[model samples]
Target: MRTIRRALDLGCDFFDTAESYGPFVNEELLGRALRGRRDDAVVATKFGWEYEGTARGALNSRPEHIREAVDGSLSRLGTDRIDLLHQHRVDLEVPIEDVAGAVGELIAAGKVLHFGLSEAGASTVRRAHEVCPVSVLQTEYSLWERHLEQEILPVIRDLGIGLVPYSPLGRGFLIHRWVEDS
Candidate 1:
């Protein structure tokens, strides 16, 4: 917490968290860390699943659920507006347009600045973008996870959307020392 606070104090303007992380604990942590300094930072968080009875998970992307999720996220983050809001995963049951439409409403209401999608296939990405401009696409992409380059990357690039690669270092497995030692 002190490290996060110090980073925020030193002109760090961006922070990322997820609803799934600790089942919302991360958002709360960031909220506490940014208490009075909320305006100084841009907070980005993901939404998709909710913990089930303290052990399992389930997908929920219904329009109403999305609204509720945003409200919950707002409360947890202690922020009036989220700098960037991302759908953590694709809900196969719900149409991507509907998901994007829900986020679009939040953007329209000034609750979220930008909309993003994570781990969505190319078709879903196209459909969602049609509903609202996707400012960014977050995915696992590295030398090892090169699947995105074949399809998702081209679609996002063609649409002029930014790509935010998670696990860019292959989740710590790509460290030079690890490769060298191996």
Candidate 2:
């Protein structure tokens, strides 16, 4: 709790938490941490997991669950809109186009401002971007993680999407919010 507060005090407004994180407790924890400062923060969260049977079930990114997921996130985070919403992982059970479409609808309804993908391949990113312009791609790419450069970076560059590499030092949880001094 103190660490999170210190980060916020240091001008860290973007916070990432998934419903799957502790199956719900993380968001509640952040909500308490952000209590009266919701307007001053940018909350990014993810969808695509079966929260009901979290400990024992499969990933669920079906279009039918998108809105409900967002609603749950909003309620838990105590926010009306998500600044950057991500598909935690690509779900084979659901088509990428359908996931994009679902998130696109959320944008139309003023629930989500931007869409993103995590741990996804280049082709999946392209397919989803065709349906909804991806503002960012959150894949692991760092000192020891350079796989994205060979293929993913090119597409991200071509599409003008931001690349957010997840270094183990900093997992793919809003690391984009931090920038080193030039």
Candidate 3:
């Protein structure tokens, strides 16, 4: 926490967290850390899954749920506005436009600055963008996971949306060559 605080003190403006990570513990930690200095950082957090106290997965992206999720996120992060809010995963149960529209409303209400999607396909991305301009697309893209390069990357680039590649190091596999066997 001290190291992270030092980095934030030195002008590190962006931070990302997800609902699945600790199922909200991480966001709470960030909220506590940034308490009075919330304006000094751009806190981004994601939502999608509902953890049932056993690590079980269930997708819920209904409009009402999105609204509720944002409120919970705000309360957890102790912020009035989220710099960027992302749908951690695509919910096949809901229409992309509906999801985008919900986020758009939040943006309009000044609850969220930008909306994004994670691990979404190209077509869905297009539809979502049409409903609401997406500022970023978070996905796994790197030398190993070149799948996005074939379709997703082109659409994002052509649309002028930034690509925020998570796991750019392939989950530490990129540095495997440097690890010596015990």
TM-score of each: 0.92, 0.87, 0.93
Instruction: Quantify all predictions' global Cα lDDT against the true fold.
Output: 0.89, 0.85, 0.89
Model 2: ten consecutive residues of lowest lDDT: 173-182
lDDT of 1 by residue, 1-182 (tens): 79888897787878989878877888999999999989888899988876664443788888898888899899999989999999999999899999999999999999999999999889999999999999899999887789988888899989999988999887788797688998
List the candidates ranked by TM-score, beginning with the highest. 3, 1, 2
RMSD in angstroms, all models?
Answer: 2.0, 5.4, 1.7
Q: Between 1 and 2, whose TM-score is larger? A: 1
Each prediction's total of clashing residue pairs, residues at least 3 apart in sequence or on different chains, is 0, 0, 0
Model 1: which ten-residue window has the lowest total lDDT?
49-58
Residue 128 of model 1 has an lDDT of: 94
Which parts of model 2 have CA positions greater than 4 angstroms off?
53-56, 168-182
- Indicate the worst ten consecutive residues by lDDT in candidate 3: 173-182
lDDT of 3 by residue, 71-154 (tens): 988998989999999999999999999999999999999999999999999999999999999999999887778898889989
Question: Mind giving the per-residue lDDT tens digits that candidate 2 earns over 1-182?
Answer: 67777888899988888888888889888888887777777888888888555572678898888889899898988888899999998899899999999999999999999999999899999999999999999877765667888899999999999976667644544355454322
